[model samples]
Target: MNIILGASGQVGSNIVKELISHNLPVRAVIRSRNPGFDSQVEIRTADLFNPEQLTDALEGGNTVFLLTPEDPASNDIIGETQQIINNYKQAIHANGIKRVVGLSCIGAHVEANTGNVLMSRMLEQGFADLDIEKIFIRPSYYFSNWLGFLETVEQYGVLPTFFPEDLEVDMNSPIDVATFIAKVIAHKSRSSDVFELVGPQKYSSRQVAETFSKLLDKHVELQPVPKEKWNETLASAGFTASTTANLVDMTQAVIDDIVVPENPDAVCLPTTLYQYLKEKLEK
Candidate 1:
């Protein structure tokens, strides 16, 4: 059986659908009951931090899809994430799970001080010694992240971003990420591997604004947030002090070009920014 953690989330939900379409046996692990999944899916409720619950969720599962969700309001986000990773390790061991598909980020190879990317680094390190087939899917910055600014773009014709207007950075669609993950899970490989996933090309904040303008039929402009104001902007968005600091550090790493794909020949998904935005708008 295949077990999907965070099954209600954007990527995980899509993975569930993709696997179900192939008529595979799946057990969806979620924190709460969600009626959105197909009736063929077996639903299991488990808190990631609770070892017993997680163990029960992984019972009889051969391959598990794992990811750590960020909690911006937590006082100790890193500590909480470590505890959850520990729980996953124990559960996988106790249930004799054979494989794990970890959802990681592009800069996860960097061993230290990349802020939020550190979480993915820890995940890789934590599971390194397990006697199981491990596959890490390291994806670029998510295109869905821009969805948060849709309201601002519609109302004010402005797109707010931390990066400079001209700095090109890697980005990918969550749908594409999910599709690749489902494929990996279906075809379990023998040796451990890392797959770096990105969109067809890199994009700049200006390019993103242009795409939004074309899709929205408005004169949307890029509004770069000054570094001095990152704190205030994040605080107004309700991030706790520590979370804001982590996010700012992560943003700076991106600007410094520190966060990057380790593999030069990383797989590029077919969806372009314009096509993704057009489909999203049509929906």
Candidate 2:
């Protein structure tokens, strides 16, 4: 059986839909019961942080899709991920999970001093001792991150970000990532490996704004929020100090070109930023 963790979130929700479209049975382990899923899907209301509940949710599940939730209340990203490591290890061992599809980011190759990438590195290491098949998906920066700037666009006709306006970076949609996950889950003889998923093209902040402008049929300017004021700006926006600091460091790494794919030969998904924008707008 294939079980999905973080099934209520955007990527996991889309993965559930993709799997269902293939007429496959999936167990969705979510913190709350959601009405958005199809009737054929099985929903397990459980908190992954709770060991007992996590073990229960992992029972009878062979292929597990693991995605950790980012809690804003916790300022310690590393500490939080450490707890996740413990939980996953205990639960998978107790339940005898045979296959794992873990969600991670491109820079996870770095084990230290790389902000959020540290968590993914730790997660990848945690599962290594387990005698099971594993696939750690390292996707590029999510294109849906632009949704955070939509209010700014509506209010000021501008898309603001810490990234350089002209610095092109790999971007992928959640839908494309979900599709890839579904395919991997359905494939019969996939060995344990790491995969880097990216969009059909690279895009800069300015190019993203231009794409949005074309879709919205309005002038949208790209504004780079200054790094000097990042702490104050992010705090005002309700991010904790640790999160703000990690984000600043992560964005700096991107600017320094330290977050590129470790495996350039990995397959790229076929979703373009323009195609994603048009579909989102139409919805």
Candidate 3:
């Protein structure tokens, strides 16, 4: 059976759909299973931190999708990552899961310093210890994040452009990236791989606003805010300031043209910002 972590998320959900579309049995290790999945897929709820439970979840599964959701407050990022890696490391060795497709970030293995670079570096360390065949899908920033404030943009004509309006953002629709992941996961290959998944073009804040305006048929304004201000804005809506700052800094990096896709094979897939907005907003 195939296994997918973070199965309830947008990427995981779309991957499960695609795997089912290809008629493969899937085992999902998720905190909560979404209702959209087929009943044939096995759903397991277990404490990820517990080594034994994590190993057991890998049982009877040949492939596992490793998608670790971030915890910003972890004092020792390296230590926290080690704990997570030990689990996957043990599972890969014992169960010998042939294919492990890890959902990671764009600069995951790059030799550069940036806002989200820490997590990518840690994932690099964690992945290195694994014995099984692996593929790391270092996707660019997700476009779905913008959908959160669609109502605000539509009604107020203003949107919190997460990254700078001038920086080119490597973006992708969650669905398209997941499809490629599912294809790789279902059909095993002898070769190991790491691929960056990005949108067709780099888009700045103004460009994103332009895309929104064209799709929604209304003028959308790009309103840049300070990291602290962005924190206050997010806190009012129920998120921590530090977490918001990381997001804001990441966006500002985009504006400063700091983010880049290092992998030459980074795919320019078929989802556009306008289409995402049109489909999401119309709903």
Residue pairs with backbone atoms closer than 3 Å in model 1 (clashes) = none
Model 2, runs deviating above 4 Å: 33-35
- lDDT tens digits, residue span 1-283, model 2: 8899999898899889999999998998899858489998898977777888999998899899996567655679768778877998899999988899999888888744676666677888878888899898999988888978877886789998888889999999988999998888888555899999888889999999999899888999888889898888888988898887777778888888888889768668998999887888787
Number of the candidate with higher TM-score, 1 or 2:
1
The most accurate candidate by TM-score is 1
- Candidate models: Cα lDDT each: 0.92, 0.85, 0.75
lDDT tens readout by residue for model 1, 186-206: 996788999999899999999
TM-score of 2: 0.96
All candidates: CA RMSD (Å): 0.9, 1.3, 2.5
| Candidate 3 local distance difference test against the native | 0.75
User: Which wins on TM-score, candidate 2 or candidate 3?
Assistant: 2
For candidate 1, report its TM-score: 0.98
Q: Which 10-residue span in candidate 3 carries the lowest summed lDDT? A: 110-119
